[model samples]
Target: MSTFLSALAGGALIGTSAALLLILNGRIAGISGITAGAVMPLSRDTPWRWAFLAGLLLGPVLYRLAFGAWPVVQLDAPWSLVVLGGLLVGYGTRLGGGCTSGHGVCGLARLSPRSIAAVATFMAAAAGTVFLVRHGGW
Candidate 1:
């Protein structure tokens, strides 16, 4: 498949899954919230959270099994930097009320003003980070 087609398919799958989650479970498909709930239970919603997290972890492996090749992933940063980045992102998701999938996909689909603002902020921050990384010495 061409890159565009593959990306379109991936996006369609993501949107469909998010829609299905909302329709069937009456829950937003927020990965960060799901992960946190899985780690620390607040109610009786633990099982589905665990299942969702497991699917996320196993998606690539299943794809590899079906395709006979692992998906390509490129990591240019050091392990320490990667870990730090992940930690920062986790923190940011909590602070901002949702992750990209939640705000950018599900929330936006619901025509939420908060999600629009969050997405705009996320995009600006990402653009600035890329600029600083590529042009300015970090």
Candidate 2:
């Protein structure tokens, strides 16, 4: 499939999954929250959380199986920089009350004002960061 078609399909799948999680489990499909729950699992919720995480991990493998090759991931940053970036993102997620999948996808779908503001902030910050990295020699 073409890139646009693939992206559209992926987005549809994400939306469907989020909606299914909400309807079936009464839980938001926020990846960071799900991951955190899996890491420090509650007795009642651990099983579903682990299952959700497993599905996430399986996506790429499924893609590889279907496509005959794994997707290419080119990371230009050093390992230290990558780790630092991840840590920063985690800290930011905590400060922001949730991550992109939470605010941008699920929360926006629910028509939340807070999620709108959060998504706007995320977009602006990302734009600024890209601008700095590309133009400000960062």
Clashes within 3 Å, all models in order: 0, 0
Provide the overall lDDT of each model, using Cα atoms, as 2-decimal numbers: 0.90, 0.89
Q: State the weakest 10-residue window (summed lDDT) of model 1.
A: 32-41
Task: Tell me the deviation in Å of residue 80 in model 1.
Answer: 3.5
**Candidate 1 stretches greater than 4 Å from native:** none
Worst 10 residues of 2 by lDDT: 36-45
| 71-134 per-residue lDDT for model 1 (tens digits) | 9998899898899899989899989989889899988998999999999999999899989988
Per-residue alpha-carbon lDDT of candidate 2 for residues 35-136, written as tens digits (9 for 90 to 100): 877887666678898999899889999989998999889989889989988998887886787888999899899899999999999899989987998899
In model 2, which regions exceed 4 Å deviation?
A: none
Candidate 1, 6: how far from true, in Å? 0.4
Model 2 pairs whose backbones collide: none
